[model samples]
Target: MTDIQFDDRVAIVTGAGSGLGRGYALELARRGAKVVVNDLGGSPSGVGASASAAQRVVQEITDAGGEAVASTDSVATRAGGAAIVQTALDTWGKVDVLISNAGFLRNNRFEDLTDEEIDPIVDVHLKGAFYVGQPAYRAMRAGGYGRILFTGSSSGAFGHAWQANYAASKAGMIGLSNAVAIEGSAYGIQSNVLLPNALSRLEEVMTPGYMEIPAFAEALQSTDFSFADGRMTPEFTVPLAVYLVSEACTATQGIYSSNSGRYSRVRLAEAEGWVSPAGTTPPAVEDIGANFEEISELRDFSLPAHNYDEFTIAAKVARARGIHS
Candidate 1:
């Protein structure tokens, strides 16, 4: 197969100062993309900022003979998001790809989380994607070409202890990507979510003892997995991300996960549910309780592409039961 190249494409990667975001920025630049490396240079806990973080990445790209510019803008606010995109537009005239990867962790147990803790996590991860995505999406709609990738997390999709805020924020990215994918379909723009399990600064801060956990340790030692220095590094996850944000990737509304060398699709599926028989009095609570197993069974499941698809499935079942809307 021929190599995929960015060439004249302009890409924006938020939180590009370090970790996963930095890995993405560097790879995109290396592949011929004119990149806007946006980083607030904030601490892992979302406190403090400096220009050096973004500047260093930009300098690295330039030194490697790639085109890039630095934007030290926070993605947590609307103005900041717009400024980041504007930097890309002013520098390259158009944004062909967007990787909404800016975020910091503020992990806490559900009960212990205060507004102070919860708000910033939502602001930077969930709302931040929205803020940066909307403007870039608009630009893409006008140009009639774009690829968008939002950073999601297994903590949100599956579940993890003591990371309620982080999980909620990351999970929200799936919904955001779904909306953008549906809306942008007519404009030739695609949006997808990525759940990456890589060792990054944010992960380090959020799970200080992760390596000590038996499951993590065993996974690290597994022959089935591949890693650098016994850890899943951000670079290991970058290839998938780069492909998802490249023009060659035409899939939209996809949720994919990458850990170590394993890559897979994560989907939301609905089981074929029990429906009340026609001509029978409406099922009672007792009836529902008796049929609970059938209702919850996972056999013959279907993945709904959107809300209407659920209704379509319900209508089919209802019709089969001799009921009409």
Candidate 2:
């Protein structure tokens, strides 16, 4: 196997001050990619700010014989997003990679969630990706090559309680990533989403007493990268990320999850559903009721890679009805 390297690449890692983002920046730079580390240095709850977090990571990168620059601009605003990308351009002349990892946590029961929690979370996670993604896409398009990664959370897939705001925002990244992947395919720009589960300060917000919980405790038993039970670190997620955003990867529009020291692909599939026996008119209430099992069955499903693929079932229905050739 050829050793993967990024000797001539330039990468922008948002939220690089700490946690998974910090690990990503270090590894990418160690592999020869000149990195622009952007972080708001805000608290996990989305309040307060500092420059030390970002600058510290930059210092670590440089001290390790890697090239890196620090940017303390927020990813939650358009101006900040543009400025973040501009930082990379001004320093390196191009952006060959983007790890859209900037986000803060704000969660509560759906009914108890206030606009304060909802708006900022959405603005930083979903809108933040767009604010930077659009400009980064343009740079990638002009250069005709790029790799973009969106940091989505697995909580979005399996409805965790008290995570209404955070989960929704994370889910939005998948859609944005899919759209970028489709449009970028022709330009040699690949886009993918990551659902990372690593031990980080956000745990202070996500689950205050997680260690005391039996389920959370049992899952983190030093599988490989972990040193003990209930301690799965961010370094474990670095290699997977580095590969996905490298020249060797051809996958795009892909959703992946890394949890409990295991990595897997999560898919968005459409099930083959029961069709109404009668044509043109909608199915009767009783007819629909009779086929609930078939409608909900996942025995036969198709994974649509593009928007137009959704009509496949419709075409099949039309053919069965002899509606057209």
lDDT per model, in order? 0.90, 0.88
Tell me the RMSD of model 1 versus the true structure. Answer: 3.1
Model 2: per-residue Cα lDDT over 1-325, one tens digit each:
9989999899999999999999999999999999999998899998988999999999999999999999999888999999999998999999999999988887676788899999999999999999988888899999999999999988887655677899999998889899999989999899999999888888778754434546645665533553435546898788888999999999899998877667899998887777765457888899888998988999977788787987876577557656634
Per-residue alpha-carbon lDDT of candidate 1 for residues 223-302, written as tens digits (9 for 90 to 100)? 45434455598988999999999888878999999987678999989987888767658999999999999999998788
What lDDT does candidate 2 reach at residue 291? 94
Q: Tell me the TM-score of each prediction against the true structure.
A: 0.91, 0.91
Which consecutive 10 residues in model 1 have the weakest lDDT in total?
222-231
Q: Per-candidate RMSD vs. true structure?
A: 3.1, 3.6
Global Cα lDDT for candidate 2: 0.88
**In candidate 1, how many clashes are counted?**
0
Model 2: pairs clashing at backbone N, Cα or C within 3 Å: none
Tell me how candidate 1 scores on lDDT: 0.90
Model 2 regions lying over 4 Å from their true place: 207-231, 317-325
